[model samples]
Target: MKISVFAITATTIVAVFAVSGSSPSAFAQVANRPVLVVSSGVADISTLDPDRATNVGDVGVVSEIFNGLARFAPGSADPKEIQPDLAEKWQTSADKKTWIFYLRKGVQFHGGYGEMKAADVVYSMRRAADPKRSSFAADFAMIDKVEALDDYTVRFTLKYPDSTFLGLVSNYHGGSIVSGAAAEKLGNKFGQSPIGTGPFVFSQLVTQQYLTLVANDTYFRGAPKLASITYRMILSDSARELAVSTGEIDLIGGKREQRWVKRAEGRGMNVDIFNPAEFRTLFLNRNIKPLDNLKVRQAIATVINVDEIVRYAGKDVAEKGCSVVPNGYLGGNCGSGGYTYDVARAKKLLADAGFPSGITLRSVVSNASAQQPIMQIIQAQLAQAGIKLDMEVVDHATYQAKSRRDQSALVFYGAARFPNADNWLREFYDSAASIGAPGAMSNFAHCSVADSDIRAARVEPDPLRQLMLWKQAQQKIHDDVCAVPLFGLKQVWAHGDRVRFGYELKGALNLQPPITELTTVTRSAP
Candidate 1:
């Protein structure tokens, strides 16, 4: 699936597009132009509605226009640092299953709906938990009830005490608060156009062109420094690199290839790279033939040259993934000591599985420029082990849709999950998250290799013990051969010197450039 949150595409880049809010006089055309122009490598945004967005690209925009009860520390990339947003402060009962939130007063919704109140917060959160209304409902399903106690206070009663609950409802994009009045007034069309109490207000979405937003002067935090922000979709990697190099765009998401990394540095641009990043893992359908056989799965794992694959995958941009949870992840980095690259071992396993001569299997992958090369490496690696992976390259979005239906024997998926370890483990290995299950958004592989460990980890009150449980769950996944934890991808975002992030770039929760109220764009020194 095209999750540039787990995304990478190859296409030609073009000039940035600018739209003036008002028709300018012939002499004033340049004067009314936007102060800042940015480029995003997304092919397109799914929806502006936070509840409907499944990909990071859409969530990026949603985050800009909404607030949650809490948020990742603004101006900081550390996912562990959480601070209040809509909720000025909150407290949990002694049991830790009940939460009381005191929202900030004087927050106003865009389009002047009125002051944001506890009723709006209650309505917004309940809508997100409603399975029929949100694909993200499963993330918040633990909440048994939500109550608005007053105009500025809300309460949540949970089924259990989950340490990740605050993170689940706030740091995750699904927790974004939308105006209840606006949502009802607009209905399904709200996704096309949305209203929120964020630093920016949605102005326009020109298909395949750009999504433009104007600053919210009355923002509770403060007015954004940039007068307007334009998200230009750049499909071509080479073009995107060139745009940043030539200063045609203030910022661009750089390609994962190390060569691109070096080239950008050569041009004197600043590139930010961080770890505990996306996981580019291969999921083998256990319900499918050959793959379902334990020996066959083992053989496939033994033959995969993960090191060589990373060699081709930009060693500096990525490294060997240790587990289902990437290194330094929330629960704690742990791996299921995978089989080494040994062709003989692979052959022996294949023979033991009764396929002495070898077996041929078909797999599907996205034909995106960056992905094809990696798949080709896997194809070649498998052939050496006498297993032929007949590769079918499909459009990225189609691959995501088809994979969820169990359409392929093998699937290559990538994602930058919420920082919590349980979020990743459960979505990939929980039966409840299996494809076609109610409220399923991920879990394309349809395998539940470690359901119990993950469940145990979710309820573990002790932080250290909880992390240990999460690690055990990842080990279970690796041992079961449900998927091969390929490598942890290091994300790169390059920008010209003129744009200031206003903070250190660590790791992002949603894998997008961490731009927020405190972010600023300063003119480069003359």
Candidate 2:
């Protein structure tokens, strides 16, 4: 397969919004306001509480209102730099078990809440570790306890050494620290009215309609340049594009198709695309026979045409993936032995596995419109290798539960983790962590071949050494043909002339349009 690299240089070329949807004079009327109108397709942003933020929409809202101890820089090309936020500095013991953090003084939470301190950090983190309070409780399992050493000092004792511990508690949505006083005062209502030490503070949430946030004037990072930001829920694809094209909204979460990219660019709008991409991996259940047969598995892997999948599934918005842990990031890419698209080899392997007559493989997938197309593409590709994919379409939740329960012979799962590869390799391939094993997040394939390497990688303190262990695990997965790696989801977003990203394009955690404090708006972009 030929590798393609595409990059667009950002220039201030501007155009007028001419698409027929909203009023033509809209831009002029809204030119003076320092409000950014973002069109997000997510319709279920019911909470602002970071711990309970299950969807990317809620996570995006939470990101604006909260700060983790450390965070990814605003316009960083890579997610590697661990910059301090609420925590001024942090250090770990030589054993790499105990972590101490010194908090920044005078950082205030929204709504005139008292100054943030070590106690607030401890309270927030402890609450996030509780299973009932956080959907990502498993992420915090490494923590034995969190203690406030003093008013500005906090300590965390870990059950074992974990190199990705900082990222898990620093950049992930679950890492957002809320004001303990605010949570107690507001109780369950805290999710709607969140208070944090971020650049922007929550102003109001209009349910499924939109959310509003105003600049935190006393923000430690300095007041956000944009006076306010308004996130609008525009679920319809046509409507969303029209809004951006007609200048009704400043920006919209773009569709993944290359054709959509072309349309947005043709209109002279700015299209922003970046990585570490979300991986769309094809997992074949080893617990099921035939698939349990190495030849059959290898045959399916050979026939898995990722290029065709990328063509059909938005080539511009995806990269041909090589590992279960996406192609790029701190994790090393050791995919020299990865499967390439070869139908002849697949046919031979299928015949050797006693599937010359063509075998039917049962599968289950989410019936969501975005997901169904990719599943159909997989079904079509498998047919080329004398394998009939009899996929049963179900709702999103059912698909996840059934896949985890080991009910499917084939599962095409698209996902992104917190820019780390260690936890990803463990939760997906380690026997003790996968679904069939006890307390599994998602081991859909029920794999254990890389269990030892994955375990070793997790506890390795040195970043390079830990990455070496992770590559070993990744290689094991590649050699076993444990799963077919598809393309990573290419994220694309388009904005009108009225707005330009305040900072350079950078990586984000699957939030379609990550509008950070650095995202800037012009008095008029054109």
Candidate 3:
């Protein structure tokens, strides 16, 4: 099991086989070349196919190699304004049920694959929607059909008016376009090794150690500045810090350790801090006892001091979170402010709900160092309320599997992207979102009331009316204690001074990195 890190960096570089020699001279010789070394904090690159990937770490890599029809510009805190990637421009019908897109010309897939066409976009959408593929298609479930009107023009028909349709299309995995022919030829292996029309091309996979990519001169947007990028898998956070400090690697991904963050800044290493519009929270399975009772759930939520946790996590590392809907989400009503840290109130609620002394609650947490503190703090707080929490920590893979099965009374996890309140409400409260389902994504709470309110918000298309509906949904979910919201994570990364890139403090880490905006900086003769 590797500790996965999520962030976006861009470049163009050629692939070169490293000579098998363990010496500083070998590394220093290559240091002059434009390269970024990342600790593959996570295991197996898994599927390079964005549509199939659920982990944020995987998406970070996928975003580099693939070009979506539309992309969230780097530094876009809001989802309403999306910049072009593959598509030059797009328009929506006045009724908001139809969409038309114009594809960029002269864009070719890596490896001289072929020219990108409108048919490819249509095929990709169909593939994403196919039941056999089983990607995160529910977000696009409202799309009734997709058709190529011309060589560069494509149209999308929706089942109903959806204001969030464009935002959904810009989703990390939702918007990745795969070649129709490649999908058929490679079958399942298509995910392991994907071909895209982006700035980088897949070169070689060296098992668990690392993956190598070369620059695509034929990239539609423009030629990438770097010649190559080597992603090294560094599982241990300490090892990653050491690698970055010692110059063994050029960059470190995801949130860095507090010690490393300070060290990197002190050393003049570029430290990018990004605040994603998402939060980590404790999800309560309503089917379970104690948590099933609204008062007990609310009491538990009120007892935790989020500000204290944020302070402990480190300054500029995290901010206080109020609700499932992130602060800037469209049509979102942020949940009530500040957790009321009242042990007396918690005790009374637990006792009133017949969950008094000797009541043991099970909490399933992911085996990550970052999450450990949160669990420990909650356990102590719950104990004071007369609730004994049995902490069960599992590896990431097992944690992800069990979470979907709803096997725990409580689960602590984070949503990678929460661009809109719909994502928040839909996953936690829709009937189809329940753990036991043909389309279950992450509704581990098994919250039926939340599901109803979320459904109502989804169907309401009027902007102001939709906001009202979403607010009601959030309030209802909060009032019912569907889940206890934690704090929003502030992403931190460490990189060597040689590399240059921009970081978006909101949305996904990459959006539009410096690679797309600047020329590659070549090493000057020292």
Candidate 4:
């Protein structure tokens, strides 16, 4: 599909449309508006609902189509740079348990919905707090109440003081405010047809093919430079790279390998290797058979060489992950170091655990280019220590499902959160978040070794006390061998020379170079 550049006026309204596979060419007819066709390494999207966004593709699209009370400044992923969005300003009580936000009046929602108000904020916050409606319910577990003080004002009461409260309401994850009217009217269909007050409006989604979003002419931050964006699902790396090289697509998620980065640059494409890196870690399921033994878990950790993995991944795109909290995040405990890679130590540990001959571990792995290679390297390394890794290779979606269902003895997963220790520790290391728990999120290891430290760190008002608790939690997880922290793979993307993101690509919380209001495409370029 193709689109060209144009302008929107006060009298003009862009219509949101969806088409079936039969009408694949519908977007090609959009007269003068240019379309930025981006390629994601997924077969399709699961949902467009901001509250339930888990996949990187879904979050990237949701980031453009929605707005939270506060937002990380455009072109940067640093939490310290977060600024007001739908909310004009905010203040917290002396005890830091109560918060008040003043709304920006007259801001219109997409799809003819009425102006946003304090009630919508209250509704969205309450929706996020409900586990049935959100995958991020744990993020708001501390919230006691959210109320509309007036049409232009909203207030929040927390069960305990949290230094990371600002991040809980920022434009990431469940903090994205939904249109209360749209949520009520659309109901379950809201995921398919989302309406928010951002620079982009959801327009068309041709499943397995492309999802298109048109510009919001009445965007609070003014209109986007590009007329629209078409996120195309291209599962093949070589094919996607070819498409971008031939100018068939504006941008494509590049393979997370050093050679791939060099190859793209050689082809004269603009390669953006941005943060925060998805910290890759192999979690030994504490609930599983052999993995339940501490020596077995420590043996597995010792055999894996994170330094070799980083070298294989191309040092430019990967960093040695030192702790569970990841290196760049605030309150991260990287100074403590990680498991030393020693084949002899691994063999000794395995023998001490009563496995002198050999031991085999089953793991579900994603076949995506970014993951498959890393797993393969680990498998080879593990074999040297008489540890056989029986990897169940599956598609990314299937891998995620199986790992969460506790189907694998080992879960090798990677993710980039909001750059905070509490966010990572609470969701992955807390006992309340273990898989199969009543309100489970992503604790694939079924790990509870650091639950006390994680919990204590959250409400610890003393800055040093909180920091120490976070470090203690990480140290416990590491010493207990709950998971082996591997390497952090930075996001790799390549774009055509004609496209300009209008900002230096540094980091994006969505794990991609976000196409924002300032991003533009020179369609007339040869």
Candidate 5:
């Protein structure tokens, strides 16, 4: 949802009165004061560019300055229950092929970019669909057309009925709206200096240091409690923990390493560990040797003890993943309940697949501390099945590029957002979504079963019937061993007492904090 900065002035006045004695001068002093020092993790955020930001760090900064058609409140983590942002309310056709959104009026873009208009929504969606624009939201190719019905209305026509359309719009990567006039004037650099109707206006951004934002008094939503917010970049997790402990920072995003959780909790800090709507999995490249065989894939999947990995990773940190889709996802049936930790079956499968001394499979993974132990466990498990596994760890950016380029035989990865059954399943499996293709988002498994099932499910409209088709598709994905299901990601964040905001366990990291709901409490004199 869109958050206009216009309401800040009025909000500050009320907030000050509510907290301190209702003296005008005292209220002014509190209103002008900055409240929180937030650690936004490591990454350069100088460019307020959303399109180029593939990392979570950049998205966090961009989210504060920009907004989309719909948004989520911080305390409420449900991605499905999207509240009014730019659009007050919307409706879908009976067939689900058409969607009409009613826009909120009188919203002004930051930096006097322009007034909110239906044309702007149309322009943003069209630009995202355009190949030349290079939007991360290009996966929305499922949409056939977007039309501006009027100054305060926009309509979307899909190729077919898609129950997941709203979920797709909630994707923070490229779903945030941009002014058409600004895009025309700035061209490709429009993303670098985005102007939106959010609670915060872009003030200054420094690389690998901090992102500074000032409250937008012209925000349409109620003004933010904090006069200003600085997203400080802290590289080391320990340093981040220290910063929060010493009251140097206010909040720490995402899950921290297990060792730091206890230390942070000991300091009387609130450690929020929630079940996220994302899943992590191991992708088996069918184009690669050994993994090309279904038996080899099944052997690998059966050998790896997910329970053991969950134990090592910290039980509270993750849930065991049984299917490609996470447990709470729409159309997710947790698979046919077939996967089991049977080392004997793994060995037999490997032998039947022509592995005398096991197959040597190359596995690539990101350099996160949590991932290292998981990979080691997988390696040891494979060895028990007579499969010799070689592990290669690389930096996150390098790993992402390598996985996309299809250079790795087997790779460990996760989906950042859950966009219904269609986008999540079809984009990753449809034959049209092979690596290097336009619609491809996560097709690392390279399985024909995924391709066939996605094609059939797309045309099915009946909700119950479509779910059955998706179930079959998931079962086929499991049987093909396209990718070994791993576990659901547990979202954990730490916050100092000075800062207060709500968040959910879905969408991109930035989408969680409904900027309007963010409140910065003053420190009681200790």
Candidate 6:
């Protein structure tokens, strides 16, 4: 297996719309205006409430319908580009534990939910802090309390100083503010019929079929150019390609493979490969069998080949990963060079751990288009050094259920977070987020070796010291062989030439080029 590192640059492949026969009446009646239809390889979004959103598919929809106190400047994933959204201005106390935000006046919520104010922000933050209410409740563990100082002013008192608090209030996850009145009225059904102050309003959802959104004419930024948007859930890659090629879809999530890129370009589709790449890692379950031994875990890590995995994923779509914290993130460090790949050393270590012959480990593998191929390549690579990986193929939902219950000895996971090391480290490596723990997240490794460094980095005031703490945590995790960092796969999407996204598409945190108030679709000359 050969290791190849590609430049971290956005690339284009040459990829707009005619509605399919099955499109709804809203899509048909918009002759004077354009209707943007988009397709992605997802069955459907699980929720519209931003607090409960656990994956990119749900966040993408929620982003269009909600506004946070702050937001990433459109078309950028960089944390430095964060700008004010519902909050016109904000300031923090001298200790950095208390933050204050002044809300923008006259920003109306959808469905007649009325204006957004400090009360809504307070209510939303409270909801986000409750474990039962939000998947990201642990993220708000730093907040001591949230209070409405006045109609337009909101204040947050944190338990400790957190450098990433600003991102927590930005437009990604729990930061997305929901209407207090609407949430209380709708109750559990609020996820289905969400109301917010974003540029788009949720119109309809048809289970596993599709979702529709209409332009919010009362949007704070201004009216969106497209009259409506049809977000269709097309899981089949062939069907999506056909739909986009036949003018049924203006944009479609693309495959992260070189062949797919060339094929889309051949069909005249404009392809966009953007950040932040979803970082993949193989987490070794310490509680499971032979993996309980540190030598066995180290042997497993030594046996696996990351270079082979990157080759299979294509250098254009994937970048070699070397840190427990993802590469290219703030406080990220890949300078340790990672563990050297040596099959002979792995076999020797396994023998020393009482596995003289070989050992078989079971993993629950998802049949999702993007995951199966990578897992298969890994299985073969592990077998080369006497580690047998028995993968139980299952549907994505089943895979999630089984993996959560600690059924897998090795968990292959991929995720992209707030472009900060704290977000990734705290969720995936912290002991508190270990599976089965209260308010558990995706800490599949049950790793606690770097808990002190991880916690200290959060409150470290000096920038240099803070980054050093983060690097120390990563080094500890790496030395412990808690997880084998694989590769970072960039997001791929194709759009029609007629679709003009008002800003240059550099990177989007939501995993899709956001359809904003500025985005427009040109109509054909009659």
- The per-residue C-alpha lDDT of model 3 at residue 386 equals 76
| Consecutive 10-residue window with the lowest summed lDDT within model 6 | 7-16
Model 2 stretches with alpha carbons more than 4 Å out? 1-33, 92-98, 111-113, 159-161, 184-193, 203-207, 287-293, 312-316, 344-356, 366-370, 391-408, 436-438, 461-468, 510-513, 518-526
In order of appearance, the predictions have TM-scores of 0.89, 0.82, 0.88, 0.94, 0.87, 0.92
Candidate 3: misplaced stretches above 4 Å? 1-33, 75-77, 254-260, 335-339, 502-526
Per residue, candidate 5 scores C-alpha lDDT tens digits across 156-233 of 999988765665565266677778888788886765667777777665555666655667666787666777676776
Question: On residues 1-526, what C-alpha lDDT tens digit does candidate 3 reach at each position?
Answer: 5543221123212213223221122112233345556664676576688678776557777777787788777655456557777888999889888999998887876544578899999988887776568467787788998999998999999988886666666636667877777877888888776877766666667677777665665665555666556778666877777677666676776443466577668866677776562467788888888677788787788677776676766667676676667655666566445457888888887778776663688877776666767788888877877778888888666777777777888888776554677876776667687888777778778766666557776777677777777877777777777777777766666676666654433445442232432334434454
Candidate 1 lDDT over residue span 1-526, tens digit each: 4433101111101111224332111112222223456676777777888888876578777888888889887545465688899999999999999999999999988866779999998898899988877877878878899999999999999987887777766745579898999999999999986888987777667687677766676789876665566788778887777777776677777777788788889989898776546788888877679887989999998999898878776877887877777665677465457668899999999999999999998887887655778889889999998998888888666776778787878788877767678788877778788777875766666667788888887877788888788877777777878888888777778888878776777766666676676666664433
Q: How big is the positional error of residue 107 in model 1, measured in Å on the Cα after superposition?
A: 0.8
Better of 1 and 6 by TM-score: 6
Question: In model 1, where do residues sit more than 4 Å from their true spots?
Answer: 1-34, 333-335, 462-468, 522-526
lDDT of 4 by residue, 180-295 (tens): 99999999899998989988878767788778787776777776777788788889888888888888788888988999999999988899988888988888898888999999
TM-score, cand. 6 vs. native:
0.92
235, model 3: CA deviation in Å? Answer: 2.0
Q: How do all the candidates rank in terms of lDDT, highest first? A: 4, 6, 1, 2, 5, 3
**Candidate with best TM-score:** 4
Question: What C-alpha lDDT do the candidate models reach, one value each?
Answer: 0.76, 0.74, 0.68, 0.85, 0.69, 0.85
For every model shown, the clashing-pair count is 5, 3, 15, 4, 21, 5
Q: What is candidate 6's local distance difference test score?
A: 0.85
Deviation in angstroms for 200 in model 1?
0.9
lDDT of 6 at 68: 93
